[model samples]
Target: MIILAATPIGNLGDASRRLVEALETARVVAAEDTRVAQRLMQALGVENRPRLIALHDHNEREKSADLVELAREDDLLVLSDAGMPTVSDPGFHLVSAAIEAGVTVTAIPGPSAVLTALAVSGLPTDRFTFEGFLPRKAGERASALGSLADERRTMVFFESPNRLADSLRAMGHAFGGSRLVVVCRELTKLHEEVRRGTPEALAAWADDGVRGEIVVVVAGAVPRTVDLDTAVQEVLLLTATESLKDASASVAAATGLSRRTLYEAALRARTR
Candidate 1:
């Protein structure tokens, strides 16, 4: 059997009973960081010393098969530095390998920074997305955020402290300064803080130097209420008074639809 354990995100108290029991009896432990695993064991008062193996993003794929081989006979435990394994952390490859090798894989569910932040974000969470981390480069980040400008589901992203201010600023430009957002920092810890406001306001707050791990939750775009046929008619009405290009651009800008798409629709309208 292959057991995936979720360690505490920050607070040690959040560790589950099954996770401790798993750790105490396991023969081999594949950890993201061996030192962190040692620390967790100490904190949990777990005396059993399982043979710790480092399985991180840099080497998870490479080591998956070997770990699965060991699990064929004895139980092999998996853990990430925080939260559940394979959640923007390493463990996915191992899970897949275990399945292929006919090994039973299960999880000891516990703390999660993603769900925790989203629950307290004050945004509609019925439908949402977890965009692990944004690109480090400015252009890539802008392009990524711009692509999601029309996304109706709430979005979540993980970001480094140093880049938090810049990311929020870019989001303000892409999703707009008025878009609702919450910056969750050091969650489940003493310094835990959740700041809610527009991206612009949050960006300004980040300027004071935010610290620790950060999770950003942003409300999805509320598309214009205009339907497709109505939007096409509006384009036609504008084209009667202006050039097709100008009309399409104006309608597209107002409706938050693609300008080229609107232009093509306008041409079809002329034919029809």
Candidate 2:
């Protein structure tokens, strides 16, 4: 069996009872950083010195098979430096390999930056999507945000402090300056701060620079309501530069209208 354990994001006291017990008994542990795992065990007062194996982004794919094989004989415990493994962290490939090999996989769930940030974000949490991390480059980031311009579910994203300002600036452009955003910094830590405002507001604040692990939660786009005739006209205009299918899909996505309805309306309008 393969055990994926969640580690505390910051506060050591948040470590669950099951996680500590797993650490104590596990014969082998695959960690994103072996050094960090060692430190964590020390911090938790766990005396058991399990064999530590490095299983990070650099080697997760290569090590998955071996890890699965190892698990066949003994429970293989997986840990990231912080939070749950394979959640924008290492362990996804290993879990997939384990599942494919018919190896049982289970999780010791605990702290999660994604869920922590979302819960404290004050945004609508009834429905949400975790966006992981944004592209590092400005152009790529913009293109990614642009694609999600019409996302209706509240969005969660992990971001580095250094790039937070620039990302927020691009978000202001893509998601609009007035869009509500929450920046959760150093969550569950000494300097934990949650700043809520428009993207433009937060962008300006982050321009001075910020620090610590960051999670940004943004309110979903307001659904656009448009009549079929108006939507069809918009689709027709886009068809001048895009395919009929592409144009219809784009307009439908933006307007929250049925793609088939838009396509048919635009098709009939084009015939006229």
TM-scores across all candidates? 0.85, 0.92
Please tell me which predicted candidate would have the highest TM-score against the true structure. Answer: 2
Tens digit per residue, CA lDDT, model 1, 1-272: 88889999999999999999988888899999999999999999999999999999999889999999999889889999999999999999999989988999988899999999999888998999999999999999999998788677899999999999999999999988889989999999999999999877888889998899899999988868787778888898988789999888777766788879888987898898
Clash-forming residue pairs, model 2: none
Q: Which residues of candidate 2, in runs, are more than 4 Å off? A: 235-250, 258-260, 263-272
lDDT of 2 by residue, 1-272 (tens): 99999999999999999999999998999999999999999999999999999999999889899999999999999999999999999999999999999999999999999999999998999999999999999999999999899888999999999999999999999998899999999999999999999888898899998999999999999979999899999999999899999999988878899999999989998998
Model 1 poorest 10 in a row by lDDT: 249-258
For all candidates in order, the CA lDDT equals: 0.91, 0.95
* Model 2: residue 191 alpha-carbon error in angstroms: 0.8
Error of 2 at 91 (Å): 0.7
Which candidate comes out best when scored by lDDT?
A: 2
